[model samples]
Target: MTTEHLDGNALAGPLGEIFAVDVTTCTGRCASCGLTTPVASLHVYGPEPGLVARCPGCDEVVLRLVRAPGAAWLDLRGTVCLRVNLPD
Candidate 1:
């Protein structure tokens, strides 16, 4: 058997579908390690209970997304803040 692992870039499409803007380019500050980087740089894993995004610096879970038939849940507790570029 073989296992396939993907990076944070794989999250771009799914996140784009949920957010009106592109989240891959957004910068997120890791609460655990105080490191800030593009959201696309985070380590991503799983589609089981939900998609988990972790900080590359400290391996802390920065975000979790779960999409249901009619609902979606996004958790960002491990991130201090998310800096997104909004065009005017």
Candidate 2:
């Protein structure tokens, strides 16, 4: 799929201020899957604030969020972008 997503620095971006996830589940599609699943499980281990967690399904990292922000904006590097309101 797209490799534009940051690996480690992602956690340092707006995501570092995120709150948390309600659930973690596998969706089976690498392109369609959300990084939130493995991130919710805390399956990834990283000492650095900028750390990457691998997706359980694709074995490729889907990035990780540390603080779980209240306002999250997603940028596809050079593609489309989105700003989402995170749950409280």
> Against the true structure, what is each candidate's TM-score?
0.88, 0.33
Candidate 2: C-alpha lDDT? 0.37
lDDT of 2 by residue, 25-52 (tens): 2221233344333233322445344344
Q: Please give, for residues 1-88, the per-residue lDDT of candidate 1 as tens digits.
A: 1134356786887788789888989999999999999998888888777788888888888999888897888999999998989998
What value does the lDDT take at residue 84 in candidate 1?
Answer: 88
Model 1 residue 45 CA deviation (Å) reads 0.4
CA lDDT, every model vs. true structure = 0.85, 0.37
Pairs of colliding residues, candidate 1: none
Pairs with steric clashes in candidate 2: 17-69, 18-67, 18-68, 18-69, 19-68, 19-69
* Lowest-sum lDDT 10-residue window in model 1: 1-10
